[model samples]
Target: MNVILPTVITAGLFDSLNPCAISVALLFIALLFTLKKDRPFILKIGFFYIISVYLIYYLIGLGLLKAFSLFGATHFITKIAAIVTIIFGLLNIKEYYFPHAPIKLRMTHDARFKISEWAYKASIPATVVMGILVGIFEFPCSGSVYFAIVSLLASKVTYLTGALYLLLYNIMFVLPLVLIFVFATNRVVTEKMINWQERQGRKMHLILAGLMISLGTIMLLLYF
Candidate 1:
């Protein structure tokens, strides 16, 4: 309980710092500002978008947990997840150093373009779709932490308990977005946030690299 709880919380927080999701969220806010939407409307759109991301991510976790349990491959999955997490960490480091790396963990160009189109729509349904798209597309960049956590849950807890932990983890996961939406309601703050994200993006990858490498190494040492 002690170790697992901390792991879930830390992993969720780390994953929330991912560039993919944050970038899209900031873009959505900027778009809303350009549309001259009222504060209430903007808040409504943001709420639905965040909720969509939360639900989609939660469902994805449930699916992975069920698959691991059904296959009786918790051990195998954990080993693979650890290895993949380390590889992703190294990739993040590579991204930090060589920003033009041929292989990168990020949303595809097409996904970004599609998301932008939806963001421009500035409608509730469009924002919901954009959020779902972000939740799915951002997985490539941010999923290593989630995979590791899910693998741990499958190995250490029953289905119901794992579901509960997943719920908690996902709440933490979308927390940053929630905070950003709450605070960055104005154009000035939103623009500053976008600039900050662009400036600190590489550093975020570096931080993620360190955390992922450390977590993966620990998992390997303890389980493998």
Candidate 2:
């Protein structure tokens, strides 16, 4: 139990640092800014959005854990998961060289458009919906860490414990969004934040790739 909590927290921290997630939050903040520059409106919408993302991601984790649990803690499943993680890791690494590659995990144009459309509604409920959609769209980019942690939970932890860990993980995952909203409201998040992210994008990819590869390799080594 102790081990599982720490592992899940670590994975959550890495997943939270994911550039893909950060980019989406930045876009949402930009959208909110366009709609209303006031701190209250932005804070309200952003808070709801983060809540929606957190709740949906937690449910998804539960679902994945339940599904993976059905596989009966098989070594084969771990091996397969490890292999998939490595493939994703390698693909992320490749993004460093071919940054424009269409293969890098990202939201489809359609998905982004839909989220934007939701924002246009200018309602609290709409923001929640947009958050749900964003979470779905971000699955590809964030799935590796989620899957690895859930797989481990399925094999080694109880459902309740897994759920608790998931709660912690998701809270960590959305911390950046909260911070972005707070900073943006305070006039701290400027063009510089965006520019910095752009400049560091490649490096973030490399870090994610290394983390994923290391995770995969660790999973693989379990069999040895």
Candidate 3:
């Protein structure tokens, strides 16, 4: 699998540390605590939450890759997509290096909706609904990152390959978040998360953004 999805997964986890993600995580933690929801329950909700968000995002990426193939993008268009990915990737790099660049992600730990009272099957629908909602809800902010992957997948030889590219992309993208959810659920390790984000998060983000841009640039050059 192309590393792009994994790269995105890393980005998402690291992003959790940024002003946005940390804030969301903290607020989420607080929110969970407020509801008297135990760590175990919170963890389960978050697990489904991540799955919901990722599945929708991954499907969108896959669909877009296939959709664009039918367009048979003109050389100009393909190059343009490559260029956009490069630029958005740079935005990530900029945020990494100079975090004060007014980058803010207004994420909520609010679960998009809470379903603790519902049965497992009812909650299953919540994932589908939440996935679709988050996909549409966060599109504007996440469009560039999503586009970066789409552009890369579009470079593949076949639509199925492109679909697989996105599938892996989502997996990679979720890596950090899963680990985080694990730690966040652990009473022992949770304290470290918020403070770490405050001090060292930007550099982590820099590394992530830089890598994506670099890969995007290389691909752009090769396929431009």
Ranking by lDDT: 1, 2, 3
Tens-digit lDDT string for candidate 1 (1-224):
37999889989999999999898888888888888987788889989999999999999999999999998979878989999999999999999999897998899999999899988988889988988998999999979989989998998899999999999999999999988998889889999999999999889999899889988998899785
- Candidate of highest TM-score: 1
Candidate 3: segments with Cα more than 4 A from true spot: 1-26, 74-77, 96-145
Pairs that collide, model 1: none
* Best by the lDDT measure: 1
Residue 106 error, candidate 1, Å: 1.0
TM-score of each: 0.98, 0.93, 0.71
Worst 10 residues of 3 by lDDT: 113-122
Q: lDDT of all predictions, in order shown?
A: 0.91, 0.80, 0.58
Please say which candidate is ahead in lDDT: 2 or 3.
2
Q: What tens digits encode model 2's per-residue C-alpha lDDT throughout 116-141?
A: 89978868999889889988888888
Per-residue lDDT of 73-178 in model 3, one digit per residue for the tens?
A: 6344456765775676567677666656676433333533432222233344554564456555555433555665565556555788667766666666556557
The residue ranges of model 1 lying beyond 4 angstroms of the native Cα positions read none
* After superposition, candidate 2 runs with Cα above 4 Å error: none
Q: What's the distance in Å from true for residue 113, model 3? A: 12
The true-structure Cα RMSD of candidate 3 reads 5.2
